[model samples]
Target: MVRKLLPPLASGFLFGMGLTISGMTDPGRVRGFLDIFGDWDPTLAFVMGGAVVVMAIAWRVQARMVKPVFGERFSLPDRTDLDPRLLAGAAVFGVGWGVAGLCPGPAVASLALSPVYAAPFVAAMLVGMLLQKLTMERKVSNP
Candidate 1:
């Protein structure tokens, strides 16, 4: 169990450290990124670019591996095509991100440092997730 959890835990710790170092833990920095008409900050774009590069490399590495260090195999989402639900979700996510300036991962990480911002962010995120789940459940049941 320890072996199974260690890699994911280490990855999460590194991710949190990156968020902390890049000022992603700061809600004001994120809010500045969202602000286009006001004093805008483009630093978050650089951080996102860096993350994209890292994710591309990680994807390549994972593709080459037959099995993950901890798991039998990586279970990735099978969906390859976009649909209305996907598009709508993306739009909603983008709007929420633009307004709040904090994505879920960084928001959760920021909780350890700043509850004043993180608490509301997390609460909203939970509500959004719950709503999505309920909607999906209703659709599934009705259909």
Candidate 2:
């Protein structure tokens, strides 16, 4: 149980700490990054680039490994094709991120740092997720 939980817990903790330290928890900072036509902040680019680099290395390591360092099997996304649902979801996510300046990761981390402000965002996010699930279920059932 501890083994199963510890890796995820530690990873999340480290990710949250990184977000907080990188000023990603600050909506103003994120908004500034989104403001490419105006006072654009490039810091988030560096953060994202660093993440990409890290993930690239991780992917390379995974390619050589038979199984994950902490799991029964490496659960991976099987889909390689794009659909309307995927495109729409990505669009909605981008719009929401631009408007709110807080993606799920920073919003979740902000729960511990600034719950007063984070609560509504988190609640709405959960509601949105539930709605999406139900919509998808209905579509599948009807089709």
Candidate with best TM-score? 2
lDDT of 2 by residue, 24-94 (tens): 99998999999999999999999999999999999999999998888779878766757788899999999
Query: What TM-score quantifies how close candidate 1 is to the native fold?
Result: 0.83
Itemize residue pairs with steric clashes in candidate 2.
none
Q: Each candidate's lDDT (Cα)?
A: 0.88, 0.93
Query: Which lDDT tens digits does candidate 1 get at residues 1-143?
Result: 88778898998999999998999988788889888799999989899999899999999999899897777868887667578889898898888777887888889898999889789989999998999899999999999
lDDT of 2 at 21: 99
- Model 2 residue runs over 4 Å out of place are 78-81
Per-candidate TM vs. native? Answer: 0.83, 0.91
